[model samples]
Target: MNAVGVDVGGTKIAAGVVSPEGEVLAAVRYPTPRSPDKLVETMVRAINEVGSGKDVAGVCLAVPGFVLAQKDTVVFSPNLPAIEGIPLKERVGPEVGFPLTIENDASAAAWGEFRFGSGSGVDDLVFLTLGTGIGGGVISHRALLRGAQGSGGELGHVTVHATGPRCACGNRGCLEALASGTAIGRRAREAAVENPGSALGRLAARRGLLGEDVTELAREGDGVALSVLEETGRWLGIGLAGFVNVFNPEVVAVGGGAMEAGDLILASARREIRLRARPPSRDLVEVKEATLGPESGVLGAAALARNTDGAYALGG
Candidate 1:
């Protein structure tokens, strides 16, 4: 039987029908609704569209928030404030009429990688997603590590610098604050402003934006953009070293738009991790890019639903 996976993001909600082998059979997407009620309705529509006339066994949802494993309530999410503390399982359960499992987006992505992507052969792995912000997940011995209070694997909040920059979470010097996509864009904008003659400035001016344009400029050998990416990569490496030392996972999968800069970003991260991490840990971990790209979360969520127990049990 197939499963339905819903990936709820700040901008859009994507639902897909997935097979046990990780192939997506059909997908439906729509802009995320603003209110909590509308969001649920939108999700239901997407689920129905993809699940119609199919033998869907269950549904899995990946949301960006602190989810209570037992209740499937979104305790808090900086991006989706309107849905804070919303009981997801209770709200959508009756409508979908299938066992539903919910997980943090990052965790779902990691599970997706573990079951179907690059981390398939590894028992221990760390997943760092570099999107609007940094998010992370951890797996050990083929099981997820959902720490006390069900908020484990928050790799973005790990402190990399004590006096760096302020984060959206109201924390200072967090890894996300220093090396996220937002951080990269912010730094590139600053660099363009400070160096009007640089290629980055020209690209930003032409594109009317600072993100991918700047990264593209860096790939084209723009000095200012290169510097920004290098700095961002260094911060990511510093943060990754901590994880390397602590978890000693066999593989580290880096995913997200920022990684599209290719060696401009990852090369520096690899260098930094090699320089700072312990010999044994560094030697054991193989840092690589995520192969599933943007589909990892949904694929993983579907995988979760497919593998869940006979009937969906809310909290483990």
Candidate 2:
């Protein structure tokens, strides 16, 4: 069966028609509007473009933030604020004119990977997305770990350090406050401002330092940039240490734009996990880059939509 998936991000909405085998048949990208209603319109527009005015078996929308227990509404999202408190599935389904499933973007990506990408065949696994903010999803024994409150894998909100940096989640020392792309960019920008002659600083002088810039600089052996990533890795490793202890997953797939740094981030995180996480389990889990790249969310969303059970269940 074919299904349509929409991944709603702060900057863009990615919509796609996906085959049962996880192939993306058709896709479209639309700019995200600032207004909540317009955002729904954009999502519907993308669906129409990818659906080609044809009805699919199901539709799914993947969004960031804490989704409500009902899954039809977004409880809160630090990244995409407009949709907060909005009943997305209810609002979108009428205009979309179909059954709809909604899930956290991170969960969607993890499900996509478990079903079709790097984590395939794995009974237990974790997925961490290092984007503007951190996003997380966990699968235990082949089931998506949706907690009683539907916020089980909100790894970004986990406090990695006491009295550490403040997170957008109204907390101090959240993992997202330390290891996210936003954190890396902040560190790099600070480094550039302090040391204008350095490689990272030179790039920052040209344009603002982005997480990618730090990664590229670190790759080129820029000491400051490398240090910043190493710190981030260590922070991630510490956070992963807790996840490893709790979930005991077979693998942890780290994805998102910042992962372009590849081994630079993984190596440090591995080191920290090894140092911090308990013995056997820490050694058991391997951290790898997510294979599906940017398409994981949409692919997973499509998979959710194609589910046999009416296809609109929240937190499925």
> Could you say which candidate leads in lDDT?
2
Candidate 2 stretches with Cα past 4 Å from truth are 53-55, 306-316
* RMSD (Å) of each candidate, 1 decimal: 2.3, 2.3
Q: How accurate is candidate 1 locally (lDDT)?
A: 0.85
For candidate 2, write residues 1-316 as lDDT tens digits.
Answer: 6888889898999999888888888999988898988988898899878887554778888998998856578888998899898887678877866677778899989988888888997899999999889999999998889788776799999998889988998899999999998888887888888888889888888987777778878988999899888888889999999999999999999999988988888899999888888968887998999999889999988888844467432223
lDDT of 1 by residue, 99-208 (tens): 78788888988988888898998999999999888889999888888887677898999888999889888889999998998999889888888988898777667766
**Cα-based lDDT at residue 302, candidate 2:** 87
lDDT of 2 at 56: 75
Clashing residue pairs in candidate 2 (N, C-alpha, C atoms within 3 angstroms): none
Give the Å error, residue 23, model 1. 0.7
Evaluate all candidate structures by whole-model CA lDDT and list the values in order: 0.85, 0.86
